[model samples]
Target: MNEEINKIRELLDKIEKKNDVSEDSLHGTFDYFELPQIIASVIDFLQPLLSPYESVIYWFLFRHSIIETADRYIRVSNSQIAQGIGSKFKSGDKVKVASDKAISDNLRCLMEKKVIVIVGDTNRDGTLYKINLPEEIELCIERMKKSRVENTCHVEQKKDLDYYNIAENRLLIFERDGYVCYKCRKQLTRFSATLDHIQPVSQGGDNSYSNLITCCLHCNSSRGAKPIMEQFTSDSKVF
Candidate 1:
């Protein structure tokens, strides 16, 4: 453990000394893209929104630097991760070994949040499971790359802006709008309904309560990028 800590410290020193890296390089199994700080920032900002298993799974992918590829096509048996977590605790007397059931529950939580896609059963050949990061994660990855290039912490500020689109906020908006299309007054059973920014995101509108309105898929498509006021005044108004 001491040796591993020393190695990590050495790597941090190297990263602090050098600032050259690329997005592709960051995806490797052990490549340090000299943006550990930015990555850490993103994780810290997002950790509150993730479960313990979700956090572990994310770091596992990060260590391997396979977010994009994993999202495209990935697979891992439930038992594998469970065993991995168990092994991690075996060396520590104080840490409790995670049960298979606990690992399974976290996996389900991750799936429900769209953080990972289950490609197949763990009993299959490879126990395939694809990791699908949310748009916010992808944006964070991009911002990390940009920060490495620009040598700025602007990406940190953008984190809050991205938070507005998280599932919790979306759900709140859906509930506030009564899960019904504001224009057509059509009822929506659940998340199937679209969330239209009353002020339009393109026009600097936010995802706050005052700016959100629920709409059915058909109505949402018709509205497109047009501003709400414009839609109302134009013939495209669905109401």
Candidate 2:
């Protein structure tokens, strides 16, 4: 009797894998605000490799699982997959769904390509599958990483000039010092604040980011060319 029961348990286990929570599903921290970039990455890197049917199914699954729900796992059956890719109903043509075998074949091909994975076995509802993003696919990772680096370098190129002379780069200094008068500890707005040199231009200061400071008009004109120390000392006494 124990042997028979053990065999039954084993069969049951084989039929239904547990629907345990997956760590990847729990990591729902991806910013959907970057959805445009993610979509672009998919178009530029992943779409070229997929066949017509695979592309359709992959996009369908992506929309339902990731875009609609913001999770990678979904429980769906072969019939549902076929129906999702139903034939067009234009001009009263009878609507027809894809065959189960065709849907199964495409899904198997995707799994072999490592674009998706079966996370749990079939049950009354459906089987659980995990959809891999472009970045997560092993085949796409190297290209995706390269694209991200190129974007970063492009942004870095914008800052490769003199900070004091360039209006955009000048704002960087004011923003860095928070648009405040450094000597007086006064808050300032963009229109009212001015950039001052710690080492006077007449002395040796060139227009680099490190040599610049934010100051109000009053502190700027009053401290002109005076040694930087005088601004900090009292008019009546020196420390």
User: Candidate 2, residues 1-239: lDDT per residue as tens digits?
Assistant: 99999999888776654443565463456557656665775787688768889889998888888788877788889887877875445456666677788888999988987888998877766788898766456566556445545654454455446777776566556655655678786766444568888778898876776677788889898886965755664673321
Local accuracy by lDDT, each model: 0.54, 0.71
Best candidate, lDDT-wise?
2
Candidate 2 accuracy as TM-score: 0.54
Task: Tell me the spans in candidate 2 whose CA falls farther than 4 Å from its real position.
Answer: 1-19, 26-28, 88-94, 145-156, 159-239
lDDT of 1: 0.54
lDDT of 2 at 37: 61
Q: Which stretches of candidate 1 lie over 4 Å from their true place?
A: 1-45, 65-72, 90-97, 136-239
Q: What does each candidate score in C-alpha RMSD?
A: 16.3, 16.2
